[model samples]
Target: MSEEIRETQQQPQEQTPPPAQETFKPRPPGQRVTMKELLEAGVHFGHQKERWNPKMKKFIFTERNGIHIIDLQQTLQYFEKAYDYIADLVANGGKVLFVCTKKQGQDIVKEEAERCGMFYVNKRWLGGTLTNFQTIRKSVFKLKMLKKMEEEGVFDQLPKKEAVKLRRKKEKLEKYIGGIENMNRLPDALFIVDIVREENAVREARKAGIPIVALVDTNADPDLVDIPIPANDDAIRAIRLLTSRIADAVLEGKMRREAVKLAEGEEADFIPEEE
Candidate 1:
């Protein structure tokens, strides 16, 4: 025992290393739109035969168990094209309107669009929203006025019943257009989750001559969209994944725009050669 203790005393003991600090490195923009991601999110699965849109027959790879299987290769190519278009659009200070009123689409689209500082419509698509933007803007203005009045104590001076009525009206308007209250004009492009479900929005966007990037499933008319990414629109996972990729592209565009502005500012402040 004494000899073992003496041997241990001659050896150096190991020391504990410091814990790693977690650093979050974001995915490089459209890099998320990969075949692995698409497959993991069930993006290749399409609608059943009974619900399939004949217009989308060209994008279908095969028929299995009465369900259509989307061609991932086609989806990848089209998605890349769409991503580049969206990136360029945002880098030029263009706006994109995300339209997805269905329950599955509402939350994901709203979250992603807001994260990228883009506008969206997650609730009911009001008729003439694009054509009669003036009327909608009026409603949004009224909402803002009421909110400002409340903040300035104007509502406190009113009758209790009148205050309640105004508050209720504001809530109603918020449900319809809160996501787009800050939108001063029509968007440069429209990104839709379910093209068929939000057909009115698509038609309005087309009427405004705005570009459209849409998730065209087997049950959706692919020709209706300007840029169609053929995928499974019904799957929540797929929608979430694709929307995230779109949002990332927007984010990258915004970053590029800021970089360009900074570079321009630097050039403007530079001292030229006297010669």
Candidate 2:
């Protein structure tokens, strides 16, 4: 079959055609995403069939020509479960770490993590970041110290050569651990973009007993993650949509947590009238 013919046959007639230029606008926290939105974001498109992993067979809807089509219905179903789990986790004072080292997803990962007020590793995933967290905490402390020194004007008073050296050191730390400077403890869970590309992160999370919620493509094993939402991991639009949804869930969870705190505080402050 011709490529154009395969594409047409794969898409549904009822689905809305993508815009001339697709721009992502994140939905509000607690808002639900629909299958039609997923379709428009191209979440159904998977890797080529030849690159498919046998373990991902259950998530594959079908093969059109040489490409695999992800089951967006399954994606939506699993995504709901993942969303609930993440929201519940955060609601109970749990923390999540976002890890997406791929060039296509680095900026999106950083933005989403910040939007949800979670720690992230977009530039690179350092070994043992989770399993060996004590060591990572030391680096985080050092980064904070450097930042404090700069804020205190210590660097300005130092010798020029010493100041230059410290500045270089601070820049390196900022690149590696800047996103995690405030992450004093290991995260309760991990949100990974591509499991295959970030295998080290998956391994470290497993070793550290942290749950993982990840976007699993056709070429990756869904079983590696605790909650795997199967989708097109290579597409920027798909990544943006999925990550934004996850961030919204986290934001919702934070709101719920604050509400609970407020209720408890109000109850504690309530005093019975004179009887």
Q: Which candidate is the best by lDDT?
A: 2
Task: List model 1 lDDT by residue over 54-165, tens digit each.
Answer: 9988899998988889999999989988888998998999999898998877888988988788998998999988989999999999989988988999888999999999
Q: Write the per-residue lDDT of candidate 2 for residues 40-87, one digit (tens) a residue.
A: 888999988999999999999999878999998899889989889998
| Cα displacement (Å) at residue 136, model 2 | 0.7
Candidate models: Cα lDDT each: 0.85, 0.87
Screening candidate 1 with a backbone cut-off below 3 angstroms (N, C-alpha, C), the clashing residue pairs are: none
Clashes of each: 0, 0
Q: Please provide the root mean square deviation of candidate 1 (C-alpha atoms, Å).
A: 13.0
Model 2 worst lDDT window (10 residues):
1-10
